[model samples]
Target: MPAISDAKILIIATDGFEQDELFGPRERLLAAGAQVVLASPGGDPIQGMVQDQKGDTITPDILLDAVDIEEYDALVIPGGVANPDTLRTIDAAIEIVRGFDDAGKPIAAICHGPWLLVEADIVEDRTVTSWPSVRTDLENAGAIVVDRSVVVDDNLITSRKPDDVPDFTDALIRLVEEAEVDA
Candidate 1:
């Protein structure tokens, strides 16, 4: 297996992101020896939400528009109702998602995060799982929706909710490690 320590991960999120979805996977990735960076739409600190309630605030490491997608090994999209909803509307966000998908890089989405994937038109024919409410969206976008904790379809990885964080993160770390071997 490749050393995850050499991997650099890019986490895209904004206000209203689920605290655990962003922090949990990120913390696990960091522990697994990967370098992770947070990129939001702006340089200002972004707030996180627990469910629909207010939660912690996270300072982004770089602006979303400023991040060079080619510099990261993987892309992680954390789900929150408002977070993905807003992200899906941003052209740059959709472009970045497509770039990652086209590159066949591991793109991990949990909860509502998959909304951006759908918007990017990259989930078609791929199997994935997301928050219950977002499942229909994925299905409508031509994705095979499942009710599992984590589903790895080629370079795409997805989980249903915060409760699946452990498995979800583990799958992503494994993918990054495996990529190093392939490299």
Candidate 2:
């Protein structure tokens, strides 16, 4: 597992994020000693949906347009039907993902979260997994989409659904740790 101590991680999401997808991985990452910073379209707290129905909100640490990707070691995108749907339409959100990719930083996206990957135009020729609904989007974007608990291709890690959060978080930790070693 990665030594997350002092490692900074950026989580991108917005209103309508799946509660589990956002909180589950965030808590695990924090417990592992990483500094998790939440980013959204604006600085306001983003709402989360439980199983697509229940609602709650989480305050973001930074705004998408204001964030400096160079300050973080990794990025995570959480999925909710409304979350990624809204995010994909935001230019700033897409740019943040692209910035992380250009920086060669580790990234993890779970469930419907992979939608941003397609929007950022980073899925080409890459292997990934995501919630069933977005598999076609990934495929159409020229990615080799798979059905799995977790798939790690280079610095990017992805998982199929919320049920795969454990595997997703573990892979993210390993990737960050490995990046630290390589750096």
lDDT (C-alpha) at residue 12 in model 2: 92
What's the true lDDT of residue 67 in model 1? 79
Per-residue CA lDDT of model 1 for 1-183, tens digit only, reads 678889999999999999999999888889878899998888888999998789999999988788788899999999989999999998888888999988889999999999999999998999999999998989999999989999999999999899999999889989988877887
Off by over 4 Å in 2: none
lDDT, candidate 2, equals 0.91
Count of backbone clashes, every candidate in sequence = 0, 0
TM-score for each candidate, following the candidate numbering? 0.97, 0.96
lDDT of each: 0.92, 0.91
Instruction: Identify the leading candidate in terms of lDDT.
Output: 1
> At residue 179, what lDDT does model 1 achieve?
78
